[model samples]
Target: MRPKEIQEKLNIDGDRIKLFKREGIFTPENPPSGNRSTNYTDADCEHLRLLVVLTKSGLTCSDIRKLQEGECTLEEAIKIRKNNIDAEIKRKQNALILLSELLADKVEFETFETDHYWNVIAAREAEGEEFINTEDMYGYRAVSLIRSIKCPYCGEEHEVDLEDYMYDESSYEKENGMGPDVVYSFNSEDGYECHECGRIIQIEGWIREYPEGAYDSEDINVVEGEKD
Candidate 1:
């Protein structure tokens, strides 16, 4: 109620509390006159608590004042803050995966790469561990690296044009590597029929070593046509 008592209860600087009051955040129930000092009510304490939370969410004093004036609702501020936090989480996750692969001592090139590497990194970070014991799996991944392959179904060799989704590690490792490799299942437009047997074929692919000096360019075209 008294400034000293309010400061102790709110664990805030007396001046800070005074500023909020002066800025019309919440007025004392009974105004202090002459020797009588200002005292806050239970409601005032609750308002101060909300004020502290809003400030911690990166709102300025002016923003809080607007909130008090009903310029915006608390729900709106909360939604905005949540969206910002989600964006930051995605950014950090991307950085963790990219930097880990790029800075690895011996990065491997592969057609069927797995996010097992990134997932392990995420798991280790969750436990406050930063060391990556095995960097064997970390590297850039491309979608359906096979330009053409011999089909398993009809034994026919087919030319393949893959979509971008084929290269994602999570796509292959979805459900812990139980999901089917999408590259093998292609439409007629994306995959050619086997000429020898006249059967529509899903070709098997391989993981090959990435060539040296391939990382220098923006677009690294490692594999082309069928690997003989």
Candidate 2:
């Protein structure tokens, strides 16, 4: 596993070997001469080959050094890289969904609006802020009002489609008509109705929201011939 032996095994030029060592990708204690050189094992040669491929694929020498030193497991590093890829995929999916809904005339505006309203409400609550006015329940913000609805009979939850339920008649009036003034209304005398299950029970709040993002790109197996 002298330099000459490595060069012969890899079918690479001496200059390439020199370059690899200069890049700190591969190193030998002593340079090979006509009759004197240190030996290298087959495992060392394989490791060097893998390093070359990794470096060519955009990994830096420092990254390789970290791997060599056991600072991070290769599995963990791969997982981190995959997680980032997954986040990007989710972002792209959301953007596509928004764009498609915008372009379609028969899109489910109600569902999207309701989900957005609840998200905002949840965000506010997470920040330790009140979404509703405790004194006058009716004097709350649209977001607050949307969050306060529960079926008196079925106990089914309902959310207001705030975006679709806008007061801007000038814009939407020409399209799919207008929404009700009160985003949510319940009849306590009669139990609320579940939209899905159709059960007659006491409603708590709106449960309809947007679907979670699709699978993470990292988790998705790459198919052969696919160029992603």
Candidate 3:
């Protein structure tokens, strides 16, 4: 193949081929003759195809040279690429976790109308890390947690009415003419059959949502969503 033919067939630019030649990364099988420019063989074209793959998969031209010269094996380069991708995923996940916490903080400190509530996750961030700890994350948001329990089997979900479940402890104490501080603790040992999958879903734990301070016990403890 001629230079133009290689460009047309491989979709590689002519200047790129020339650059590869100058860098000694690739060269024409046939050197220039009296009147001819450059020529490529079938074998040369196959090598160029491999170069295309190497360049596209996050490998720089310098990296390719190192690869060709046996400075690093292809498998080693791929491992490096995989590590970079994993790091990027961690960074993005950390950012998401931080953002969710910040939004929830705003909700906690500021006053909101009865109908002005927004959504927020109930998950906590990792220790000394900015990312949310995905292992302890729950399926439902904090607001929804007051009434909803998710199934572990088929991802079916059930929710009760807040009017049927929740009551302000401080207000209840005041109605009974007793002086008491506020507390927002919810606990239940429940096992309900899911209508969708006909499987028993067990949720036996407690979660408190008091913005004042820390709790002596865990905030949320999910025993197991699906029961046998």
Candidate 4:
């Protein structure tokens, strides 16, 4: 077939035909002498038409040539594109989870003292106020702050240590008040006492109030009845 005939059939210019030859999509042994040459074939024209369609569908010129040469398959190309999309989605999901965990940690850290008031109680217990056992009370208080605590029942005392006394927060609320904030009647007669002796127990809980000059460091040495 003539070059002019092939160009008319493919609806392309002479330059594009030369480009197809340079890309090695289809080659003629004898180069076309001039603008008009009968060196092109019907098969060559049909190949150029297919190349144009593939290139228009987002395939690069090199990729189109490779596909025509049987070096790669269309299914492999599609799989590569999909894999890139999947990787991008996974990256975004990981970023979201990281942000959520960071926000949760920050919020928990800020309310650290409020959540663990049991630590304060433990500190007092270490200072020799022996009515309440500190080790047992710490676990109960911590769990209570986070969830709930069981009442210090008499039946379970012989079987387990105080730390083992677990109860749901709802049950504790039903028996005792919600927390130390709410004032409730204490059974002074049946309240927690020293296990070693029959002495009245003095278990220190959270303190919500302080004296007017309680935090003043300079007044530390000032006694109530002493002159400066």
Candidate 5:
């Protein structure tokens, strides 16, 4: 294809392509030539497509060309670009919501406390049409997690948002060592102290995931020594 056609595919102009060529984003052999009929091959076009996405998502052409020599795969680059896009979109959405609050003469703009708040906000926005309507938003969410649970030791029900606890636990895991977790289930170590009995209640068998922080709980039990 011609340079104009390739530029149309890449959403870039001739000068930008020239810059890329200068920076070695385009190889010497497979250059996006100006007047050549069969200049860019299928493989070249595909690579240019990937490079366009990478550059749009804030990667330098040099960085992308370096990635080609390393263990980084094309799929990983695409995924990274998608994640960067999502993060930027979410950041803008939060800004819009905050701007709405300012328009309503709200007393204070809430400082960003945790990413958990954003996750919950996403959940709330997805769950509630009411807030969206009130805020006149494309979206916004809030879930009342005033949840209660029965104590395994005391057989008494008490207010305890297990979901909130698990959120913190998962966040800790993410910070510590866990990598790119799509879904994480609770284990025996994930537990909480009972409000009534002061005994630990260990929750097991649950898939905890984001956007919709719903838990599929299997069982609630006391610790080994505590129960015995």
Candidate 6:
């Protein structure tokens, strides 16, 4: 194939082909005629393809020359590239784990301790790493979690109101001369039927909500919502 044909077939630009030629990395096998340009053979095209792969894998011109001269094998170069790619994958996984902890309220963003490596893993300089902050990460996760709760019965991941369905409610009241005081209690043993699937979900013990200043150790302990 001619240079233009090789460029079209291989999807390589003329500048790259020129650079490869100048570096003696992938030369055309055909000798020049009276007025014809140099031509590349099938074998030359195959080597050019390998050169492209090596260059994209961060190998330099000299490295390709070494490989062409039989100084190093393809498997060795691939092993080195594989190791680098594997390390990059591990770094990304660590960042995701850290983000998950913050989202699950396991770590308070403000008090979360991290080293420089963590920051590097979490954000890249090209993505505006300096402006990244985790202060409100927990709050954002809380809201998103509340919205994404899955219905046990139907396995439908959606938001549903349990106010009307919640049962096994009890209230303790004290009527004094001044006024009245009450402590309300709710247990998850009273299951709710899924509106989507019509299956009853026994939540066991999940706190819905509580009135401010109305909770004590007895009330919380009874429902297993708190431990002392």
Write down the RMSD of candidate 1 (Cα, Å).
27.5
Write down the TM-score of every candidate.
0.33, 0.28, 0.37, 0.31, 0.32, 0.34
lDDT of 1 by residue, 94-193 (tens): 5576667766735566632457666866786697654433222344333333365555645445444432113332223245533333322222222334
Query: Per-residue alpha-carbon lDDT of model 5 for 51-147, expressed as tens digits?
Result: 6777876676656776877857767766776785566666667667766755665444465345644565678668742122322333222222335
Q: Could you tell me the TM-score of candidate 5?
A: 0.32
lDDT score at residue 197, model 3, on the 0-100 scale: 77
Over 4 Å off in model 6, which ranges? 30-37, 53-62, 89-228
- What lDDT tens digits, residue by residue, belong to model 3 across residues 105-217? 67554564324322222232324433434432532122223356566777766662221222232312344533332344433334345667766544444334333222223
Cα error of candidate 6 at position 87, Å: 2.9
**Model 4 TM-score, 2 decimals:** 0.31
Residue 59 error, candidate 4, Å = 1.7
1-228 in candidate 6: lDDT tens per residue?
A: 786898898898866766676467866678333224458899988988988888888776777787889988978766776775666565566567657766776666677657744665546645733322333132111111012345654566544222222344443444443222322233334334445765544433233222322233322211211224
Best-fitting candidate, measured by lDDT?
Answer: 3
- Residue 15 shift from truth in candidate 4, angstroms: 2.1
List the global CA lDDT of all models.
0.51, 0.46, 0.55, 0.42, 0.53, 0.52
Q: Top TM-score: which candidate number?
A: 3
Winner on lDDT (2 vs 6) = 6
Candidates ranked, most accurate by lDDT first: 3, 5, 6, 1, 2, 4
lDDT of 2 by residue, 156-227 (tens): 455522221222211111233323222222222122334545543332222211111111111111111212
Candidate 2 lDDT trough over 10 residues, lowest sum: 214-223
lDDT score for candidate 3 against the true structure:
0.55
Clashing pairs in 4: 148-169
> Model 4, poorest ten-residue lDDT window?
215-224
